[model samples]
Target: MIVAPYMLKAFLCSVGLTWMRSRSPGAGISRSWARALPCKPSPAGVAAVVGTAAVPPCCFLQQGQLSLRGGLRVPPCAFSTLGWWMVGIPPDTAGTSSVGLRAERSPVFACSPMDLSELLKEGTKESHDRAENTQFVKDFLKGRIKKELFKLATVALYFTYSALEEEMDHNKDNPLFAPLYFPVELHRREALAKDLKYFYGEDWKEKIQCSEATQQYVDRIHHVGQHEPELLVAHAYTRYMGDLSGGQVLKKVAQRALKLPSTEEGIQFYVFDNISNAQQFKQLYRARMNALDLDKNTKERIVEEANKAFRFNMQVFDELDKVGRSLGEEAQDGGVPVHDGKGDIRKCPYYADKLGTAGPSCPFHAAVGLARQPLVQLVLAACMAVAAGAAAWYIL
Candidate 1:
């Protein structure tokens, strides 16, 4: 029963986390927070509904609740600063969500490097000062990694540290860019202003719409998408490049995820042969962009759109948070559907009689089918591309 000092510290920390979550008394909502690229003004009632909130990742640990869709509770934990990526799974109801109290503690089994985040936290001001120092940045990168051998260590550092100067200070990559110069201040919603009328039947404030500047950001992004095609292809490449074979790395990720990585990852599903001459294919992609002849302003516009994708995503979560919170409150009242947990798969014939369900045109099924089409086509196209490349290689 006698605990050591360190053990005592940890025990108290866990106790402390529980205490923090339970702080807001009166029937805790089963809320799930999301980890995202960076902060954005949430859609009104996000945090209030589930009583769950998503905070940006920091170097030190964080304490909060995160919910996957459909209610899988994510206990807070120490995670990497996405450097700016949202850890975002866009707003799809298909993902899981959970609600409960949990510690923002690091897992024991994960083989992680020393608390580099903690180290960086201590040096945040200093590192930002040296934001332009390539040598210091390289040293910082080398110091933060773990590898079995030096050669492999170099490779990890090579990939991880590729972008430094720009990330630290450039407007394009900095997490704080959206807050500055957009005219409106950073959105920090009040706890109760969440009950908007649409999601909650209460008389809500006129929805605080995205500011005009934000709209400009959105318009610029879409405009670029149509006029400058590189962003689309670049985004596609960025989306598909990982775990090409569903190799060991994915298998590892799959293990940690209660749902294992499985074969669904990477380009294994990709029919494209590994590009031996990546330059040539890149040249082809570049040619496509060049042919577009998108003006420089237009090209930048597309990149801006790429940026808005993230901003818009957070906006949705913000709104969903309101809806989700209201629903959680409703569930607390009487929203739990009493079935064998089997949904009325079809609309309740009763509500349907009154409001006419989209019946045969169950939009959900249609959307699901439509979503799968592009993916199937992409795979087949990649396969065809791979086969043609192989054939050409053999002919040569």
Candidate 2:
């Protein structure tokens, strides 16, 4: 029995995708997926925001309206049908796959990690571990004496960190000022005071100052290190899109599992609009992942590790998710007025979000609105004084 090959394997095994070590003789690892969901144009970039009635609409849902044009309904996954395939790195035994989109692997909450593959394969590290407990971290420490597992473990942990980092990076520079996706940006304007406080525990800003790697990532992407928490929140918003977006299917599923109403709105803040023809692209993505160069063992290890990463993510979320309930937010009605219970008028914004923050149409952010106008007045005053000085000198 192979106990473990790598620490990532152990972590992955702890979470479940460990069955990937063997190759089915006839099956190709590269499989086709559905299609890519259309990503809306970045608000500051080239992404096209779908109008309420845009015919060639790329993103299905827009503003506050779902696309009735294409009968845009939620599939098994709120992501486009091909979402799984797009995220799939290696195709499963099936010719077509729901690899990434669907929750294929079961989540495990383990305190300790172990890789059973090594025990069976090379059987090299049979010395230290004796009574590896299946439940807690202490038990796992008590069980194995595998020397090689530690090296593999480092890789697993590093890989997990990288994935988490990437997840955050993708959002930080998204060019879309839609904090409705991650509502805390309102707090970020005054981020120096509240950012580290609300998100990080304490002295968090100083902690970022020490991270050269973080600074490097930010510099590479044209952002500052302080932006990391923003990215983290952004990534978190994307990953737990169900909580953020009003994914009724996800809500129903979660509601049934956890015993709550799926329609419990004002609970999340995310935005992943349904893209068209999402089913066919996933297979294409699976091909892309498998195409990456690696030997069989390493490949399998990556797959297992990726799944393990998901589990690790779940653990992180387990700790952080509780904070979701305490979130102070609400769904916007695309900038329309609302009536209070007593029938008083409530103000809504057009491009400004729930935070009274602005985007595309915000006057507060405009140079002409926020600074340039005043700056021009000051410059004019200075220029007039200078002209008067010159005239007085000439007359004298």
Candidate 3:
């Protein structure tokens, strides 16, 4: 008879448990499972068979080793109960035994104890930190940036999220996305459009231009949507969750700094009218993700995609920083506020690379250029002498 590997493993487990019961007083075996029964002693050391349940026949047995039809290997009929702890196998299949079975073939649906949420957190930690530490975000929150810079950021975000949400909508029918897809509750297109109108006036459609970085990000999303739709989950998670959390904080900061009223026109992008409670909605989203039927490999791929999403966001920040640097001359010429009578531009490492020197708009560079001109130097010396004489006259 053809014996399934699982059945053979069950038979071996029952034999081992019955032997233990005979030797030990009131053995740990559940009475309802294996009732005591009499039988002739076998060379396998099984003194009795305790249950009437039918066990399939083994394909081959040699040298005290039992070989089953399926790909299973047991040397000396050895088994441990630990592997069954978190598995979904039936408890009564092996005469109420909990022993772990050995199989040459891997389990049908292998999973990690860590669910989707933990996987995302661990996988994207580095990328998340990099995104947060970007100079563009720091300056934006501090209110030391121009409104035009903020508008540029919003435009880039519009393009990125537009691509992502479009892919998600198209792939909503996919089995993997169906569970985690909450388009109505988490969608940002309408809100972003309202904010765009506020930023660029009614002609935002004609004025808005996507940065190169944003184009690259959108292209990646499109590629993934066509070739690997499952990856869109990671991008959705990265953008939506961030918009709910840090994005809200930025909204309040920008409103206060830019003196924008708390209206849809100014801050609609951060407003989630559909989702009243961000934390509760986030928990529900995570629960859906946790309940997804994904294998270990698929989960790993999603995690990698999430890290890529963060990298894309950081690239947008870099592009925004470049845009901000282009406005340095304007900022120095009273287009934006000056920090203590000088350019209010931040001289962080990111901007330092763009400007080629430190300290806002590089006042030192202007001084050096003026010093190179002999006429400018002679005029400066004459002014200093006149100022010195005026100071002496006033003192006298």
CA-lDDT, candidates in order: 0.27, 0.27, 0.57
Best by lDDT: 3
Task: State the weakest 10-residue window (summed lDDT) of model 1.
Answer: 179-188
Ranking by lDDT: 3, 1, 2
Report the candidate with higher lDDT, 2 versus 3: 3
Worst 10 residues of 3 by lDDT: 344-353
RMSD of each: 29.1, 30.3, 26.7
RMSD after Cα superposition, model 1 = 29.1
Q: In terms of TM-score, which candidate is stronger, 1 or 3?
A: 3
TM-score-best of 2 and 3: 3
Q: Write the per-residue lDDT of candidate 3 for residues 294-385, one digit (tens) a residue.
A: 77899999999988887887888888888888885323112122222221112111111122222334467557756645455455555655
Report residue 121 deviation for candidate 2 (angstroms). 21
What is the Å distance of residue 80 in model 1 from its true position?
37
What is candidate 2's TM-score against the reference? 0.22
**By TM-score, highest first, what's the ranking?**
3, 2, 1
lDDT of 1 by residue, 1-396 (tens): 232344445545544554554432211221111232222332333231111233232222333344322253333232332211112121222231121112122211111123222222232323222331233222212221111121122222222212211121233222212111111111112211221222223443342344333344345434434444334422222122221221122223222222213443211212223332222222222222222323455445444443343333234323333333343221111111111211221111100111122122245654555544534445444555555555556655
Q: Looking at candidate 2, what is the lDDT of residue 146? A: 23
